[model samples]
Target chain A: MTRRQKRPFVVFGFETTHDALAAEAVLKAADLRVVPIPAPPVLGALCGIAMRIPPESAGRARDLLAAADLDPVTRAEIEDF
Target chain B: MTPEDLERAAGDSAVGGVSAYFDHAATSWPKPTGVVDAVVRALTVGGGSPGRAAHRLGLEASREIYAARTACAAFLGARRSKDIIFTRGCTESCNLMLKGLLRAGDRVVVSSMEHNSVARPLAVLARLGVEVVRVAAHENGTMDPASIEAALSAPTRAVVCQHVSNVTGTIQPIAEITRIAHNAGAVVLVDGAQAAGHLDVDLSQLGVDAYAVSGHKGMLGPQGIGLLYLNPELEVDGLLEGGTGGGSETVEMPSSRPDRYEPGTPNTPGILGLGAAVAFLGGEGAAQRDQEQLLTQHLHEGILDIGGYRVSGPAPGSPRGPVVSVVPDSGTPPELAAWLDREHGIACRAGLHCAPWAHETMGTRDTGTCRFGLGYGLTETHVDMLLDALRVYRS
Candidate 1:
């Protein structure tokens, strides 16, 4: 039997909500799918928000951001339980 | 006070809280009446944006902002108002200083008693080749100025220390530390989150290179306001670059001091509130400080009477501020904190208080102590309530 493939996703952390929102706008304008999510509580409960994107496009997304001279405070892989 | 009466008092109190607020180390409460009035007046009359226009409203807001800068400078003993750069809060101010000053491969010395606001950022800098050296604090949460002096090496760029330990309310010898750091060609950035409103901070005389302060805590202003004092001689970088009020025609951000540090639309309302808070403190701040010290002393003494309870930090009658950390023999810090809130209407902070190094120093890292933080608006009755609550919990 063939197994179904799992969809890959990456999470982006920001230092401020404004930065996260700015990243979201930049990603959407570049025609990439992005979703703003609440910063995970497990990440030390700091302020600000985060974003999730498809893992396959994550590298491209990061490059796009770099080209725009915007840096993500942190990036992490999202695991499904 | 009864729960109903306490709730009513909170509403009428200048801080507009609904219960006892022992979290002044986090942020102060019962702000001076002028704080509320100033915020309201700014929102009503100071309609235009500050530093953006030459109209009456703009000028009014600018005046208010300038007044706040002056008050903060004078309060900190800063010689020039231009040295003060207003930001969101202490966290932002710390980040501004850290990211602005330190490059890769630089060495920074910090105290074991620093808040995570300083610790975490420096840790990140560590990943980028910056050396973060931690100077240890005593069991009482006091850092030895001599230890800091010893930590200094030729490559040491700056030393970051807090003016007071928020967890234990132990005041650091900032004057001596500043002197040592400067002698070694290193600048000092003091985290004044706990000191600005609680004690006299004369930055000019102290001669520290930079001071990061929280407006909401001791300054009795709204949250989202902080100040960073950079000495006139220091050449620092800017963390955020965007639209400053002026110099829009230039392709690159301006290199001027305050404008270079401050970007985006300023928090004009918060600045106005900060001005009023400073003004109100100037009149009655000293008396309030004295009362808080007495209440803290009473609470500290009373806690000593309880069996199986250990008080952290310097002993009572020592030179300390209005903060106390008590560890109970029977239960965890959170348990006692919850019990106090449930049974006695006492509100206290539990856990490491964002200062793990402090807990590690005191050997209380296993279970952080229950912190009793007092501020200018607290009273003897509050102390009695806290003591009675702890006593009942002990039994």
Candidate 2:
């Protein structure tokens, strides 16, 4: 039997939505492609926003946020239902 | 409570919501009105890096930074403002003392109620051949001076203790502990994260060798700023070495009091805010402490009245700060915190509160106690709301 392929991941969680937006701005200014996405329901129902970035660039995105002193709660891949 | 009720209860007429901010022990809220103004002024009017230029702006910024150091020195009872070294916060300050002062074979004594910021760094040193001793405390989270005295050995270079337990708010007897450590030929460092703004700290009277304090928590300044006070007689190596505005002759860092410890461009804006906070505290801090004492007393009495809730600490009259911890018989601490937040819009902290050894001593390890930290802006109404919510939870 053939297995279905998984989509590439993007999206990082933050403790505060404001932090997520701030991270997005910093990452974008650093010349990285990024977008602020609403928190995914599957991860958890909590208040905060998430940042969407390319799967390959997730590590770089994390480093940029940390360098800017914005700590994200978690980073996960976006999947289509 | 409804929106209208909240607005009426707070009665600020400036901000909406019941908005009871009680987490001062973590970091203060509603910083004096001047704090925000100071921060904004620094960002707008302030220019030029401190200690770096012959220009007027640089001189002005340097003067502002020096004024902040003077304020900190006055607050902590330091003999000279030059002895106070500004850092990123208490964590960095403690790290500077530890990494800068302690050698590989030296032994250090720290209390069980220390925050991770203190414990973790010392633990790292232990792995690197430094002897780290964990001095035990009483069940109520109070550190015994005698126990600290017994822990000191010939190799012990320093004894570190928190003036107030971040977890339980039990004030340690620092004066006695410092005397004991000093008698044993060991220097003492007090982490005043919880006590600096709440209680009066006279460094000369207490006789501690060093003190690390946070600017954001008790001092009501922006984060990323802290003060470290070193005794004039004692000297520690510089943690980071870079450009000092003066003494560019040698590539090595200057061997001065503050410049010896501080290197590179400092957090000028945060330090400016800290200066304003110190001024604000000097003027209105006593009133705020009185308010916090009243609130904490009410909280302690109310928690005792609530059945099955065991409050931690010595009796009511004993020396304690504004923080109170209560362990409910039926519910976990996090559950109570969440319930208090969602049901009554009450904000509080729960869990181990970053002092695991304190909890282990108190036997509240598995289930941490719910902590109600009273601050400057809290009122009796907020205390009443918290008590009512806890009562509902107990029932």
Candidate 3:
């Protein structure tokens, strides 16, 4: 039930929505609080969905994803809504 | 062509045989009208290689394929569609997973009721130095998860098991086995060839590293297309490498999901057909499974009443799929199958059913067993006809 934060937050975009959804499942399973949100127009997301993570948890989220062997192509911070 | 036209054409075909089909386990018959329509549309209209370009047709094909992937992912309880990779069929999917995941000298545990798809690959792997241990199922063809735990005497790399036995219709306790395997630091792979679309399969809840399914079996799809769902975190080498349409600049295969494993041109029409079939199943799957279970339970009860004919696997009222295997005390399986077809015009599958080990476990390897696989189209009338034919042979 986490929503996209209006403040600066890191978003991870994958090649496809499926990948993003998959990563979302794993990150949540690992107890990493993240939400799947639409890519900001600035991010040029390849897919429709992207995982939004709090800036503080970005590193841990990436590590958890890497452990599971999923690599996100775009890991950028959304400065605004 | 329209479904009505296709139906008329099928009716017009000169081919004549048994009036009722009871070989759903081999492949579902009389696919949904939408399946044929989608396939036809894919063939006649949606012409282009998906992921090849941004051209109109190419994009359309890509969209269709992706939509199918999404549908399958949702249906199978996968977190995302990208986790599902398309293959030729379940056999190829099994081979890809086994060959790509297991290395020589790795220890893997499997159930004794596995079809040749799993058994053959394990056999080949055994020669390459992989130690394969099979946990025997009960006489009813159900594997006890405790047996899997016991078989893990040695540290294991993986545990391969079927969600449902194709030959026995016994549903395996996958969640318990998956937990046991995970606790042992082993990955779990479930062969859902006969379970998906027929049973309630929630991959996320089941917690398996991989789940393999066939489009032709219970999914109500056409043959020559299968799906292999790999946990995005799991690393598996591509079975084949070629043009994936993307990453054309580099000879190295695109190190990404689907494209990572799916190399070369895909079965566009088949995938679309499967998508249509999946959609159809989504609407009718529950009702179909209930009807099939009721029919199978009835068949099991009738087999018991036939008094001398031995029913394979779990007894009536047990957790079972739509498959039912029967062994007669006097006649051979093939002989009985032939008699049913010639004398009673009832269609069914007979013999080892590609699981010689399962038959051997059931003590029917020498004589094989007649398998009656009920499908969504089969009704109580068909069951009564089958029961009547079976009763005639009882004397």
Candidate 4:
């Protein structure tokens, strides 16, 4: 998947409300700018939250969640929504 | 409440006298203007299934709830806002804390003075083979640290203590107890239902593993809302499980801060009210507590002077909360409370106060004393009026 991907996995999906918000907080608190968008049904939940960070910051965002001992559920790569 | 907000709520909020509301321990009445407005706003403008929708309303709900979590974390001195979990009330919070931590054959230390919220849950745990060691308490409603120490002979899972007694309004030595428990390698869980808004407590400084609070009591919020602050350093399990509104890919619950503990749709209005209440209490808590302390002193002194009544908890000038429970010489507590209410428009709680073990500790096992709880809006003059009403009821 990594060999075929051309864009960074900047869009993330969350399973719950607080988790989505917590990620937003963590990213913001670390001075990372992100955007909240609708999670497409294909992401495994209806009307869920997804955030898009900078394509270059994917590695740093993962590091942040790891440092805070936090994670969001894995969902399909977002092509849209 | 701001002047404009108070004016908007005037007709309804002005209907009752703040002096006559002595049930702050049970529930704080006449919620702040901001609190009421927030509750209304959450249902109207802020209405959205938090985390369950991707629309604007859902986003708004998520923002308000996140703000509430931040406010709660700051208020309780928690490091991360996500560590604060909103529950149905303090009882539910305590249940979540207790059930999440304890298992079969684990020893739990508790005070003899515990509200039914903590006591009842521990009872159920005891039935399931959790060993409960309830230490003896002083008649004044204070726990002897030595008694707590004596009971800690066994390896303990957690020590459950109320920060303040609901019956006697006694302020316990929490830091000391936490130290003793930590030294013994047991985590501490505080039932802060009676202490949250009434006392100054820094969860970080106190170093308790967990804290449970009722939004209605001292927090100045409405009923059906509570808060729990868990130390992320401790790996505590959660009781309820369902859709957390985030991780949907797996049948197994995902591990995170609150989503691991809180499932199902939250009480949005109540959480909003709690947030507003926390904001309202921000600068005014210390001043209100000063007044509460003054009135508590008068009530304590006047009751003793009346010659037929004895007050429970710490003596005059000793550290105490704003609660006072008096055991009268001649009458049952219910009659006294009713007479004061019917004749003088005063309000007080009667009957065991749901702390049967507490009642036993204070020598009121069969009949509970009349409990008067002080809070934000009351004054010393109001307390004098209450004292006069008690005298007439006595005569």
Alpha-carbon local distance difference test for all models? 0.79, 0.78, 0.84, 0.83
Off by over 4 Å in 3: A1-81, B1-14
Writing each residue's lDDT as its tens digit, candidate 4 over B1-395 gives: 55344334322345553236787888886688789899999989889988777678888898899999899899889988888989999999999899989998999999999999999999999999999999988988888888898889989989999999999988888899999999999999999999999887799899999999999988999899998988887777788788877656667776877888888889999999999989878875557767778888888899888768878889898878889998788888898888777777677799899999999998889878899988866666668888888887678
**Which candidate achieves the best DockQ against the true structure?**
4
Q: Cα RMSD (Å) per model?
A: 16.8, 18.2, 8.0, 4.3
By lDDT, the candidates rank as 3, 4, 1, 2
Best by TM-score: 4
Clashing pairs in 3: A68-B233
Q: Which 10-residue window in model 3 chain A sums to the lowest lDDT?
A: A40-49
Candidate 2 local lDDT, B240-355, one digit each (tens): 88865544445776565577777778788899999998898888567877777878888888888887788887677677888998888887888888888677666678888887
Question: Candidate 4 regions off by >4 Å?
Answer: A1-9, A14-16, A25-33, A40-47, A54-81, B2-19
Question: Under the 3 Å rule for N, CA and C atoms, how many clashes does model 3 have?
Answer: 1
Against the true structure, candidate 4 reaches a TM-score of 0.90
Put down candidate 4 lDDT per residue, A24-78, tens digits, no spaces. Answer: 8899998997667777666666556887777677779878976875675753454
| Clashes per candidate (backbone, < 3 Å) | 2, 0, 1, 9
State the lDDT of candidate 1 residue by residue for B1-395, as single tens digits.
33344345544555333346677877776566688888888889786676555445655566577678878778778876778899999998898889889989899999999889899889888998899999899889889988998898556999999998888889999989988998898999989898888888888778888899999987889888999999999878888888754445455765755677787778988988998888877886667777878888888888887767888999889978778888898999999988876676566789998888888888999999898888856767677767777788888
**Candidate 2: stretches off by over 4 Å:** A1-81, B1-18
Candidate that beats the other on lDDT, 1 or 3, i.e. the better one: 3
Residue B272 miss distance in model 4 (angstroms): 0.8
Which ranking of candidates, highest TM-score first? 4, 3, 1, 2
Could you tell which candidate, 2 or 3, scores higher by lDDT?
Answer: 3
